[model samples]
Target: MRYVIIGASAAGCQAAETLRRYAPGDSITLISDEFRPLYSRPLLTYLLSGEVSPDRIWLKEKDYFNRWGFTPLLGEAVVRVAPQSREVYLASKKAIPYDRLLIASGARPRLPGVPGEDLEGVYTLRNLADWQRLEAGLEGVRAVAVVGAGAVGLKAADALARRGLQVTLLARGAQPLSRVLDATAASMLMQAVGAMGIDLQRYSWPVAIRGEGGKIKSLALNHDRELPVQAALFSVGVTANVEFLEGTGLDDPGGIVVDGSLRSADPHIYAAGDCVQPHHLLTGEQWPYHIWPAAVDQGRVAGANLAGAGLRYRGLLPQNSLSLRGLKIISGGLGPHDAEDCQVMTELDERRGRYRRLVYREGRLVGLTLVGDTENAGIYMQIMAQQLPVQDLAADCRGPDFHPGLLWG
Candidate 1:
């Protein structure tokens, strides 16, 4: 058996390791457009903070290739994926045949095509190369204006502030991570980040980044506000890396569409990671989630199905976690954006910059948002996943005596 994996990021790397463990005789080829080996992406911000060197970012050292039976082709990009015929064409015009192919092509950082975006000091961080560039470029650079208020963008701001650089963050929406954190929680977060010396620019979008002599210097805002900065980073979001499968029989976009068993719409091939969208465990609706844990789980399920093992893939549950400026934030499940009459509870200490909220629908806990302390975060996720309506009931848990043990069986 031969397995050809693309992207060499979280999902693709996990699939390769799983295949090597389950079927040692299988020949594996892992390709990555990145020059370095596979790595932990969550640490990119840590790298910017000067917490670790570039060498420390690798997920596995060079010995990993020889030990795991993987033929790694680093810094190589796949130009095309012909799943109907099971062949992958490289940028160098070489084609590799495969019995099974996994398209985990990961994702590229999304950059809004505003003016001066091509300027020297402007960037969008997604890969190690991007992180390295930003770090090296920050030399003698002082103020930075980051466009986008998600985890990555805020983390970048956090890194910059720690380095004593004046950082101004801009968000198109009124709230940071509006897709994940609700308005109330986002407001609280904004207050916390503001106290830490970050200029939070909400309800603002970049119209044009003004550059002097081909280098980023100032940016024109939607509100006609111009801000000066030495550098800028746009950490908006990402789209799937599916352009290579252009002629492939897969569905639209960079990710291939897969069913409950991780089978593509074509059935002959499978796709996972940031590329593919899985059925939501709660909504039962299909959409792409660009989280690392989900991508890894998706790859594992896909690999199992490809090994001819009958494994029923339970759709993914949405969960996300983040650590910003020493404050840990974790959230899970969905709230009543469409539905009402939710039982909501909050524990807030503004002086300490701590807030926690849990929303319950009917008699079951549905969603939660926590900051400063997330030790029992996973327990809430477990309850939501299990849909358990337990001892204290929804009303009782909402009170001050909310025992932590309610999370247990």
Candidate 2:
């Protein structure tokens, strides 16, 4: 059997490994648009902050593909996939036939449409290329305007602040990480961000990016405020890289919709990672997880199914872990926004810089958010994943005496 995987990130790489392990005799081809070897995307901010070296970014050894007995197509972008012909067409006009194809092409950073966005010093930190350009552009930059207060934007601001650059974080919402954290949790996080000398502006976004001589000079915000900055970085969101699947009838505006087996409309073609919208484990609603772990798990499942393992993905559980300076945060499952039929419980200790919020639906722990203290995050996630009853242990969940043994008991 011939297997072809598009993308070399977490999802694509894991899928290839699973396929090789399950079907050793099958021919496997791995293609990636990035020229660099597989590396951790989550660590890019650390690299920018000088916390980690470039050598540590690689996910595998130099001869990873050679040792795995797979054909590597680095720096090659897939232009189109002919599902009928069972062939993958590359931008180089090369065609490769495959009995099974997995589209884990992932996503690219979304750019907010604003005037002067094409200015020289404006950037997005999604790929190594973007990081390289931003690194080069930061040579004489003293201050930077970061658009969007999402995880990517916050991380970018944090990294830049670590480099002694004045950072102005612009958010379209009332607080940072509004999608993941409630207002209280967000307020606690903002305190830490404020201490870092980052100007956190709420409910503000770039209306226009003004530049001088083709380089960023200032950013005009919605509230008639203009801030002078040497550069601007955007981290609003991401859009799935599914334009290549345009004619394949598998492309979706949200993401490629896949069944439990990760198979798309065409049975011969499968998709995983950020490019595919899998079902949510808790709500049974389909949405893209976009997180690294989700992509890896989806890829493994897709690859197993490709090898005829007949596995069904259980769906995704929303989970995220983030650190701002010394403050740590871990969130999973649903939030207060999904509180229509849910019970919300919260405990806050502003003096100690700790907070915990738990959401319950029909006596089952459905969602959680922990800040400053994340002692039992794994246990919490396990209970949420298994949909275990937590009504009896509800009182103890917010206390320090909470233990995993209690759950099993």
Q: Model 1, which residues run further than 4 Å from truth?
A: 249-251, 335-341, 351-353, 389-393, 407-409
Task: Give candidate 2's whole-model lDDT.
Answer: 0.89
User: lDDT scores for all predictions?
Assistant: 0.79, 0.89
lDDT of 2 by residue, 289-352 (tens): 6899999999999999899999999999999898878989999999668766877878898888
Provide the lDDT at 357 for model 2: 88
Q: Which candidate is the best by lDDT?
A: 2
Residue-level lDDT tens digits of model 1 in 1-409: 8878886788887777776767778788988888766799988888888877877888878788888878988878888877667788999888889988888888788788877788989987888788878878999998999889888888888888888999999988888888778766787788778977999988988889899899988989987789999899999888788888787666466356788878787655778888887887766878777888888888787777667665665777777777776677788777436225676677777676667878767667777888777778877887887778744344455455666466443
Point out the worst 10-residue segment of candidate 2 by lDDT. 400-409
Give candidate 2 misplaced runs (Cα > 4 Å).
404-409
Error of 2 at 228 (Å): 1.0
| Count of clashes, each model | 1, 0
Give the C-alpha miss distance for residue 103 in model 2, angstroms. Answer: 0.3
